[model samples]
Target chain A: MSCNVDDSDEIFDDDDDDCSMEVCTKDSHHSGPSNMPESCYVKLTADDIVKEQRKLIQNVVELTKLPGHTARQLLQEMKWSFENVAVLYYDDQDKLFAKAGISVNGEAIDAVAVRGSSGSFVLDQQTITCQVCLEDFEREEAEKGMSTASGCGHVFCNACWVRHITTQVKEGQAARISCAGETFVEGKRRRCNIILDECFVEELLRGSGGSAEILKKYQTRLIDSYVNNNPTIKWCPATDCTNAIRVTDSFDPSSFDTSVECSDGHVWCFNCLDEPHAPAECSNVKEWRKKCQEDSATSNWLVAYTKDCPNCKVAINKDGGCNHM
Target chain B: MDLKRLKKESVELQEPIEKCGVTASPIKEDLSHWKGYILGPDDTAYAGGKFEIDIVLTSSYPFEPPKMKFNTKIWHPNVSSQTGAICLDILKKEWSPALTIKTALISVQALLAAPEPDDPQDAVVAQEYKSSIEKFKATAKLWTERYAKEGSMESIQPLLDMGFSEEQAKDALLEARGDVQAAVEKLLSGA
Candidate 1:
C-alpha cells in the first residue's frame, strides 16, 4: 500500500527537480541559435570531421557527374584541390562561377587533387574541367609545372608564366606579383604559405631581390589573371548589340573621370563607367556613380520638364517644346 | 555626382554660348531646360536674322543626349517646314557622352551656315539646294524676309494669302528682317 514516498520527502524532491530542469532548459534555449539541429550536428572527432569532409567531396563528384570520356581525361591532368573543398557552381556559357559556402581552408578551391605516384598529385577524376578551353582534357601532351600565389589562389601553368615574373623582377618593372583574384606584396616571396598547408615547404621560394624583375613577373602574371578572371569585358554580351567594353581598372572608356586611376596606369575610370581591374581591389571601390549635375549636363538623352496639367493635374513632359510654354 | 566635372563642363558650355552670340540661356526656374538663340549664319539667306530654339535637358541628359528642335521657322534644306525639325550629326550617330549644351548649340549654328543638302530633312528644299543653288538662296532669303523679319503682320497680307497656314504666316513675318515684300513673295511661291 505504501510505494509512495512520505509527503515531506516527495514535496522537497519534486521542487528541486523542477528548478534544475527549468534552469537547464533556459540555458539550452539561449544557446539554440549557436547549435545546428541535432541531425545536422554530430560531435566531430578529428577523424570524423575528415570523413564528413570526404563525404562532402563525394557530393561534389556526384553533382558534376561528368561523362565517361571527360572523367577519365580529368584523372590524367595535374589539376587538384588541396583542402576545404566544395562544389562550385559554374555557368559555362557565361563563364561565371558562383561563390559557395564550402571552402578549402580559408581559400576556395574549384578543383580537387588525387594522389599520384611518389607523392605527386594529379587532377582528381571529378574537378579537372579546364576553365580555359571550357572543356575536359582529352589528350595530355604537355607536362607543365604550375603553382598558385599564396595570397590569391590563381593557378597558372609554369611555361606561360614563370619567365614573365622573373623578367619583371629583373627589370625593376614591377613591385609585386599581382593577379586578378589576388595580389602579393613586393620584396620577398614567402614560402608556400597557403591556407591549408601547416608547414612551409623547402621547395617553395620567394623574391630574387630585384624590384624590376618582380614587376615584370607580376605584370605578365596580371595579364594571365585578366585572361582567367574576366570574361564579361570581352564584349557587352548583350544579344545582337555590338558594343565592346574596354577593360580598365579605374577608367570608363565611355566617360571621363580624372580622379580615379588604375594601379598600372594602363586603365582609367570615367565619371560614367569603370573598366575591369584585379577583382580583389576593384570590389573594394564603391558602387559606380555619376553626379546629378554631371549626368544631366553630359547625358545625350534629353529629358522633358513636366508641370502639373491644368486640366487633369497629371504630370506631362513634352519632348520638343518651344519656350511657347 | 562629380561636382568638379560638372563645374568644368558648365564653364565650358557657358563660355562659347556667350562668345558665339547664340541663345544658350538656362531656364530661369529650372536649369534642366532652356531656350537657345542662333544668329542665322553670315553669308547665308538666314543672315541678319535672329532665330529662337528650345533646349530640353533629359534624364539621360549627358550620357545619351538631350533632344533639341528649332522653334524658329526658316526655309532650309535640313529643317522640317511643318515642325521646325533640325537634322544634325550629334542628334544621331555621332553622339558622344562628353558633349555639352554649348557644344551642341555651336554645332547647330555651324549647321545653319552649312546645311547638308545631301542629308536634308526637307527633301524638296534639298532638291532645290542641290539642282538650283541660286534659286534655293533666293527662296531662302525671301522666306526669311516674310516669316522671320520683325516688323508687323499688317504689312504682310500677301504672305497671309499664300497657302501658308495662318500660324506660319505670323511666324514668318515675325522672323523676317523687316522685309515684308520679300517675305510675302517667298511665302506665295513656296506655298
Candidate 2:
C-alpha cells in the first residue's frame, strides 16, 4: 500500500500489528526510475534491534578474535556487513590485518596462538624501542601498554600512546588513530597512515590510565562509527536521543522524502534528513527556496527601475509610460 | 610528550638543517612555529635562489606531520605559485613520524630539481611543463633569477632616481627580490 504521507502517523500507529506479518514482498514493480522496489517499512521494536546488533557484534568478535571495541570498529569498517568481513578474513587475512592496522610482528596475531591456555597477550622477552618516545622497554611492558600497527610493527610507549591519544581526541581525529607509519614504497620513504585497531588503544587506556572525558569520547566515537559507516542506518536527529534506526531496504535512492519517525516521536526524512514535507517533493522545495533567495538582486532592480501604479495596482515604468495590469 | 622531549626534538631538527646548510629558526618565543630557508638545489633552474618556508608544529609532534608552506614566491610544478602550497606525497598521507623537518625540506628542494608533472600541485604549471619542457624551463629559470634573491645593489639606482628616498628604494628592492616591476608595486603598496 502506498503510504499517504498526509496522515503518516496512522499508517505506523498500529503497534499491535506485526510489520513482519507479511513475508517476502517485492514492492513497486513499475521498474521506472522515479519509483523503486521499496521494502515495506518494518518498524522493529527497539529491543529486537538491539538484540540483532548485539548478536552481530558477538559474531564479529568471535570470528576476528578481536576485542569488543575493535570488533565493532571492524564491523563498522566493513559497513555493518558480515559477508564483506568474512570474504576479506578468508581471502587474505594478512592484508586485512594490515588494513585494520593491528599487529605484533608483521603477521596477523592468531588469537588461538596468542592466548593459548594462558588467556593473555603473548610476550617474548625482548626489549624494543617505542618509536614515539624512542625509549627501549621490556616486551612485558610492551604487552601491558605498548602498541604497534599490524603491518608496520612500530611500537610506542604507553605514556606516549596516552598523550598522543589525548591529543588526537582533543583534535577530533578519533577516527584515524594509527601508527605514525612512515615506510619505503617504490624506493620513496612515504607516510602509510595505516588504521590503528581500537583494541590496542582501549588496552592502553585501560592499563596505563585515561581521563573520564577521554574514555567517554572514545565510547561516543565507537557508537557513532556504526551510524556513520552503515549506509542504511540513521541516528535520530533529536537532542539527547540515544537511538538509531536501520532501514532494511537501504538501496532505494529515489525515496529521498521517506520520513520515518523514531519511537521518541522525532520524525525526519529517511533520505534527505529534513521534516516530513508532504505536498512538496524534496526537489521542488529546494528549487523554490533557491529561486526566492537567488532573485533578490533582480527583484530589487525591478523596484528601483519601475514604480507600481497607484489606482490600477499595476507596476508602471515612469520613463517609458508603460503600464501593466 | 612533555616540554623537555619536544624541545629535544626541535633541537635535533635545527642542528641537522643547519649542518646541511638549510638554516631554520624558531619563528616565535614558543617553539610552535619555525622559519626555514632552502637555497634551491644547485645545477637546477632554481640555483642561487633562496626560498623561505613556514613550519607549524602541533602539540602532537613527531606523531603528526608539521604543516609547511613556502613564504617565498616560487614557480614550479609541485609548488602552488599563488598559495605557496607544496603537493609532495611525503608531506601528507604517506607522512610518518620518522620524517623530520629537515627531510621534508630536502624533499621539497628535490622537487624543485625534479618535478613530477604526473602528480602536480599547480595544474597550469604541470600542463606547461609536460607539453613544453623548454618553455617550462625558461619560465622557471626566469622566475628564479627574477624573484628568488635580492638583486644586485646597483639595480636599485633606477628606483632611487624615481623620486624616492634611497632607503625606500633599497627596501622595496629587497622586498621584491630585485624585480623592478614588483619593486615599484611594493613601494606603491607601502604608500
Candidate 3:
C-alpha cells in the first residue's frame, strides 16, 4: 500500500516538492506491499537531517532570542526537543542555562578578567599560561595561540585544544564536548563544565589546521546525535546505509506492525531494528534470535560430526576418520 | 604531543606538592608504559601497604585517560581480585583531559580508602563487604600483609608461633600460596 508523504507537512515542508516528484515518477513501478504496515515514514538523507536540525535550532533561536550556537546547544541538551527547550527557556531562563551548562551573564569571564588584570604585567606585554601544557605565551601569542569557548573564559593553547577536541570526537564524544580547562571553585581547582558549542568546535578544528577526516567525523557524529535523540527518526539498520527513516505518526507498539522501508529499499522493523518479521512480535523475535545464537553452533556441530549407534542408541564421533568401524 | 605532555606531567609530579603519596614513572625508555605506586591511605584496611599500579598510556595522552590497574593484589570491592581491573568513573566515562595521571592515581588512592560496594569490580568481594564488614576487613588486611607489604616471611610468623615447625609452616604456606587462612587450614588438616 502506498503511504502519503504529505501528512508530515509541518516537519517536511521543504522536502515536499522533491518527495512529490519522486512519488509521481515511481508510482507506476511501485510494487505491491508484502505484509508490511502502512506507516507514514519519510526517508531522510544526510543533507535532509542537517536541514531538519537547523530548522529546530532556528525555531529555538527565534523563540529564546539567543544566538544560533546557544540555541543549538540548548536543543542538544534537551535532546533536540524544540518544545521542551522552548518551555524550559520561557519558564525559567537561568535554570535552563544552568542545566545546559551555559553561563549567559559572563560571570566566569568576568572572574577571569579580574584575575588577569590583577596578575603580573611586564611592560605592556601581558603573558598567559595554558594550564593543560603549562606553558606561557605573550598576549599576542595568547590571542593567536589560545582558544576559549564563548560563554566561558577558561583558555588553553590552540594545540592542546585541538588534541582535546580531536580525541573527544574520535572517541564518539562530538556532540557534548566540554571545555577542557579547570577553574577555581571555592578555592579548589575543578573541571569546567561549560560545554563547547558545535560551531566553536568546528571553527577551532578548522582554524587550528585539524585534519579533514576529523571534521568529517565531527559532522557525522552531529548527525548521529540528532537522529539518535529524536524519537520519530531512526537510522536504517542495514549495513553501510547512511539514510534514515522519519516516522511521522506516533508509533504504537501494541499494533505490532512497525516495519518500514528505507530509501535503499532495506526493509527493517523500526522498533527492534531487525529484519521485517510480520505476524511475529518484536519481543518474540528477539527471544528466538537469542536462543538460536546460543544453541545453533552446538546443534550444527552435533549434526555434522556425530552419528547415533544402532544398538546402544548413543551419539558417536568418528575421531580417527576411518571408513571401517 | 603525547610525549611532551607526559614528560611535563612526569616532571611536575616529582615536586612534593600536597604529597598525596602517589608516584608514577615510565617503565621503558619510551614513556608509553609506566609503573606507579600509591601509599595506602591511613585509617583504612589498606593502611601501611604500598600498592603498585601498572599504567599504559595510549598515544593520546592527556586527551585519553591512562589505563591503570593494580599490580599488587588487594582485597577491595572496586578492584578485581584476580584481574586487577578497577571500576572507577574517572578511568572510564568521567575522564577529562583536564585531569592528569597524578590526579587519577590520587583518585585510585582515595578509592582504596572508600570502597563503593554498590558499584563493584569483584562481585564476591563486594558481597562479602556488604554482608560482613568485619570479615571483609580481615581478608583485606591479610591480603595487604601477604602481597603488598614487601615480605612473605612476615605472613609465616603467626604460623610459626602456633607450634608448627619452620619447614612445616613453609611447606604449608607454599602449598596454600600465601593465603594465611588456607595455610593454617592445610597445617591443621595434615594433608
Candidate 4:
C-alpha cells in the first residue's frame, strides 16, 4: 500500500473493515484530542515477520517466474516492494537481474569459461591444486572436496569456501558476500564481483558439514537486512521487544498523533520513535529533550530531592527516611 | 584457517620481489603482528627514505583487511602527522581478499609518489600541498630527511658544536623542521 498522505483519508474510508479491532480500541482510548488524526498500524510478532517475508518472496517468485532465492535477492534490492519488483520484471527484465546481481540464463557461467581455464589445472592423473590454499588433492578427492558458487566457475576446496562464507557471515556481511576468487583482467588480477547466491551458500554450508549456529546467524542477518531496508516497518523501540509495527495507512510526519503501541503495551511515537507526545511536534519534543538534558535535568532533580541547610545554606540530600532528625 | 593462509603468505613474502621494494615479516612467533618496510619511491619528495609500517592482522586474516599505519613519520597529505593514521581505499572499504601485505604496502608506496590532496587526512598538509607546491615539496623533503632517513642524529651535531645544549639544538632543529640555516639563525637570535 502507498503511504501518500493526501489520499490516506479516502483510502481509509473505503477500507474501514480492514482496520484491526485493537487499533479501533486504541483510537477510542486516545479520544482526548480533537485535532489528532486517526492512524492504523499492525503489531507483528516474530513469527509474523518470517511469514510476511516468505509470502512476499512467494508473490515475487510467482509473478517473475524466477527461483526463490533470486526472487528474494530482487525483493531485497527493491526494499521488499512487491509492486516495484513485479513492474520492473515486466518492464526491464535484464536491468532488474543485473541490478540485483543475478546471472541471467546462465550467461555469467559462459563468461567464466575463459577466466577459469587458466586458474585451475589438472596435474597428470593423480592430483590438482586448489588455488586458494595451494594444496594438492587427489583427482578423485578433488571432485568431492571442491565447491563453486553458482554464478562463477572459479573453484576452491570445500574447506576454503566454508571458511570464507563463515567469516563473511560472522562479520554481518551475509547479504552481499561475493566470490573469493580473483579474475585476471589486463594482466592484473582483481577480485570477482559476482555475489554468491543464497541457495549456493546454504548448500555449501550444509554439504560441507557446517555448524547449525552459523546457518542460524546467517539467516538472522538476512531477516534484519530486510526489516532495516524497508521504510514502512520499524521494530518497536522498547527494550527486549522483538515485535515490530507495520503502518498500514499513510503516516503524516507533521501531525503529532503518530503514537503506536506494541504487543507489550509499550507506546511510542511512530515518527520519532520516542515516547508519545500528542500536542508537541517531533522536532520540538527533541529540542525540549535536549534542553532538559543540557540545562535543567540535574538541577531539577536537586531541587526536588534536596533541602538547604539553615546556617551554611548548602544543599543537602537526606539519604535515610528518618523523621526524628 | 587464517593461520594456514597467513603462513603461506608469510613464506611467499620472504622471497624478494623485484621492482616493488616492500617487505613485511611477523614481529614475533605470533603471525598476527607484523612489521613492514617500504622504500620511498624514486623521483618524489620522499625518495631515498625508508618508511616503516606497523601491521596488525585480526583472527580473520584474508577475509578481513589488515590494519596498517606508518611507524616512521613522513609528511604527506593522506597520512596523519600526529597519529600515523593512513587514509587509503584499499586499506578500508575497497579491500578484497585478493590483496596481500606486499600489495597493500606497494599501494602505500605509490600513495607517497602521487598524493590525492583533495581527499586528505591532514588538512594543513593538504592545504599547503594545494596552495604552494614548491613549499610543500621543501617541507616534505625536510621531514623525510629528519625522520625517515638514517644518520639523522649526525646532522644535528653541527648545531651542538656551536654551544647550544643537546636538547636545545634538537628542539630547534625540530622546530625548524630540519632546515640547517633556519636552526642556526634561530639559535643565534636566542628567541
Best by TM-score: 3
Against the hidden reference, what TM-scores do the models get?
Answer: 0.32, 0.67, 0.77, 0.73
Instruction: Estimate the TM-score for candidate 2.
Output: 0.67
Better of 1 and 2 by lDDT: 2
Worst 10 residues of 4 chain B by lDDT: B11-20
Clashing pairs in 4: none
Q: Which stretches in model 1 have alpha-carbon errors above 4 Å?
A: A1-325, B1-18, B28-30, B151-191
Summarize candidate 2's per-residue lDDT along A109-207 as a digit string, tens digits.
111113211112344547766555656777776666555544454455667767767766765656567555455545456654455555555655665
The per-candidate TM-score of the B chain, in the order shown, comes to 0.70, 0.74, 0.84, 0.87
Cα lDDT tens digits, model 1, A186-292, are 32111111221101111122322324434444444433322223322332222443222223343333332222221122222222123433332332342222124
Q: Model 2's DockQ?
A: 0.34
Candidate 3 local lDDT, B83-158, one digit each (tens): 8878887777667677788988988988898888988788889999999999899778767866677655567899
Instruction: Score residue B121 of candidate 4 by CA lDDT.
Output: 81
Decreasing lDDT order of the candidates: 3, 4, 2, 1
lDDT of 4 by residue, A1-325 (tens): 0112334223223333433324433435654322334456767777667667767877786787765667888898899999999889889988887677664223231132223222232323466556667677787777667655555566677777777889888877777777766544333334555567776677677767676888888888887777777888888888889888887756666665888777677788877788888788886885576557766877677668887674334668875311222
Rank ordering of all candidates by TM-score, starting from the highest: 3, 4, 2, 1
Residue A297 C-alpha lDDT in model 2: 76
Q: DockQ of candidates 1 onward, in order?
A: 0.01, 0.34, 0.37, 0.27
Q: B1-191, model 2: which lDDT tens digit per residue?
A: 24555565567666653356476777776778889888888788788788899988876776667889899878888888788888877776556665677777877787788788887777788889999988787667666755676673556678877878766776676556457789898887775
Clashing pairs in 2: A102-A150, A103-A150, A191-B94, A191-B95
Where model 3 places Cα greater than 4 Å from the true spot, the runs are: A1-39, A90-95, A103-125, A182-191, A238-241, A263-265, A284-295, A298-325, B15-18, B151-158, B161-188
Per-residue lDDT tens digits of candidate 4, residues B1-191? 36776788788778663446888899868798999888888899998888889999987767777899999988899998877888886676556565678877887888898898988888888889999999899878877876788755445889878888866776678788777799999989998
Q: What's the lDDT for candidate 3?
A: 0.72
